[model samples]
Target: MKKPQRSTAIFLLILSALLLVAMATFFYLKTQRQSAKTSPTKPALTVSTAALEQSLLPQRLSANGAIWPWQEAVIGSEAGGLRLTEVRVNVGDQVRKGQILATFAIESVQAEVAQAQASLAEAQANALDAAGNAEKARSLQRSGALSEQQINQFQTAEKTASARMLSARAMLEVQQVKLKQTRLLAPDDGVISARNATLGAVVGAGSELFRMIRGGRLEWRAEVTSSELSRIKTGMSVNLLAANGLPIKGKVRMIAPTVDPQTRLALVYVDLPLQAGAPNDPAAIRAGMFASGEFEMGKTMGLTAAQQSVLVRDGFSYVYTLGEDGHARQLKVQTGRRFGERIEIREGLAPGAVLVTSGAGFLNDGDLVRVVNPPMPPTASTAANPVPTKPQP
Candidate 1:
């Protein structure tokens, strides 16, 4: 009985030991599996990156404007209460300085001039008679044949006749001036932009007859914000887009001293060339035509990146900056003018920063990325098939 009991105890102990070994093996395998699942794997995305560099970029200011004449001449009538007899020039007619534009009725003015001439003739005859009488009176005064008062009266009569003759001559000169004014002449060489004078219409003095574009020159009036007005100066080159979609070159002529109260903008006057190149080629630009243009302020050193490196999201521009830990950090940036394939980085980016050039759109902030140097393509023979290895004996 004692031997059987001892064997039973030994078997129980051996079974307990085996159970402990099995439990330990199970827990070890479970821990190994949990650790394998928790460990992270490297990102699978391959991306290209570029280093930001400082480059000389052109600074430009853009604005919308209207084309206008450099100097608009308001041609009006100088003669009052005159009936227009002939309208020679109409709108769009090219005229020279002092060229006759219109004509007024000259019959009444010619009659007045004739009447003045007759009055002057009568006055001159009277003056001649007075001179002879005065000379006789002087001679009689010395001969004691005339009293002093009578001689004085003769001298006074001669003076009065001479004054009347002078007045009549002045009246004739006045009438001649009126006759010359019967024709309206262009003040300068220009193209007629507007005309209001009509045949048989009675026009008053200072009434507008025609509007001329002096020298046939046009200008671009650009409206710029108050902040940008200071950067513009005279002689700056501007590029204006014409209505015909052709680019017209212009130079800054003047800048308005005061800003418009309502729009809070200032006007920049740019002079357009009279002729683009040909004599017969009409000016491509016209007044009152809306234009869009840019002012080339100058060039400056700026940090720029390729257009692909930058991404726009959430109404803000962003770029993926390569991090030292093999990850991409999303950064916000302020952008400026764009030139060709590159964009100006105005703010939020530093020089010498590595930026992701490709696959930036698929990245998030602090996203792991695999940097890749693209491999060259294989040769045609290599791409066709692999060379079989020799069998070693």
Candidate 2:
């Protein structure tokens, strides 16, 4: 019985030793599997990078604006009559100062002028006869051939006839002058912006018949908010972008002294330059068209970057600065006016600071990033010969 029990104990010890070896192997395999799963298989992604550049950016302001004329004139008829003649001028027609535009039928006016001349001649004759009668009466009275009462009566009759003829003559002259106003003439050298009078149309006195923009000097009336008033001034340079995307040069002519009570906006006037080749081209710029004006406050000192460098979500403008731990950090920044391809950064970034210029749209705040080409400091030699340095360097 003692031999059997010893054998059983030896078997149990061997079994315990085998179980320990198996447990150690399983743990080693588990550790190997975990390490393999944690390791990344793909190569790191690289992105193109550029060094922060220092340059002078413009301090400017942009506002919603529109085009307007320097002075607008509404042409109308001076006298009321049926339109009989339109002498060549129409919409978009360039006219000189005092050039006849249209005419009304006033056939009776010609007759009235002739009648006035005849009446004037008759008045002259009557005045001569009255003077002669008065002289004769005086002579007769001096010779005692006429009584004082009779002489006075003759003098009064002659004076009454002379006054009647003078009154008739004056009435005739007024009628003749009114006839000359039948013709419509251009008040100044300008283009006819609109026309309301047509052939055979009757227009009343002081009725609008044509609208002309005087001198062809067009201007833009831009609406600006009260807060943006100080950023603009008279004679400051501006660039106007039309709806058609054409750029035209202009200068601020006036700033509104008072703000509109309702809209809190001021109308800023800017004079647009005439096209050198064709100053009178009507199709060049039409009034009442919407436009945008860029007020360039000149170049600013400090950092300026491409518009894509800014991340705008909701109302805040921000940028992503890559952290040392390969994570992106969000930074709020103040922005200034926008140029064609770039915008001015007012705050939140310093020179030599690195940022994500592109691919920011795909990144989230604090996301890990693999900078393809890291930003490098400019070596003394590289700074001296920047043109020869490799693009990525």
Q: Compared with the true structure, what per-residue lDDT tens digits does model 2 show for residues 272-340?
A: 875611335544667777888788888866666767778898999988788777777788999876657
Clashing pairs in 2: 46-372, 47-372, 57-300
Q: Best by lDDT, which number?
A: 1
How far does residue 163 in candidate 2 sit from its true spot (Å)?
A: 6.3
| Model 2 CA lDDT for position 264 | 97
Q: Which runs in model 1 stand beyond 4 Å of their true positions?
A: 1-49, 242-246, 261-263, 276-283, 320-331, 356-393
What is the alpha-carbon lDDT of model 1 when measured against the actual structure? 0.89
Summarize candidate 1's per-residue lDDT along 249-277 as a digit string, tens digits: 88999999999999999999998888742
